[model samples]
Target: MNTKLKHLVRKIRKNSTAAENILWKELRNKRQGSTFRKQHSFPSYVVAFYCYEKRIIVEIDDQIRTPRSLYNHAREKQLTREGFIILRFTNVEICRDLESVMKKIREKL
Candidate 1:
């Protein structure tokens, strides 16, 4: 792993939020033959979850006020340009129905 990625992994391990912890529990140990790193950063961006081998980035959003749709669009565009396939899900969605989310992730992989 890169030095920056190491730092990011440390940060994630130390301070994962509830949603991150839940998802990590399900995705850890390369359960699908693909390893994932949390709080992975790339340039000016920090993704909630990243699977480098699969070129997949998953972001868990809990937007209560500001509409994140527009910003998400731009972010996805930027990531797409860099050859990343982005996936977004709401906190509620992930917490309430993690199986569905995991299924979606498996499909993407």
Candidate 2:
């Protein structure tokens, strides 16, 4: 890994956001026999959550201040073209009811 990427991974490991921590606990140890990595580097992009075995990428959208629908749509399209399935959930959804989110992920898996 490049120095920047190594640093980013370290940061991800050491300073996971609340949602990332909660989700990582479930995703670690191959929860579905699928490995997950945080702050995964893609082509010129950094994904929040990635499962290579399942070809899935999960993005937790907080959207605290501005609308990101347009940009997210573009990113989703790019990932789809690259044979990745992208799943997005709002912070509210993740914080309030993660089981449903996990179920959605399993469905994709």
lDDT of all predictions:
0.82, 0.80
Error (Å) of candidate 2 at residue 38 is 1.0
- Residue 15, candidate 1: Cα error in Å is 4.2
Candidate 1 lDDT by residue in tens digits, 5-81: 77776876697667778998877889867999878777766788899998999888775423367867788899999
Listed per candidate, the RMSD to the true structure in angstroms reads 3.4, 2.4
The residue pairs in collision within model 2 are none
Candidate 1, superposed: residue stretches over 4 Å from native = 1-15, 64-70
Backbone clashes in candidate 2 total 0
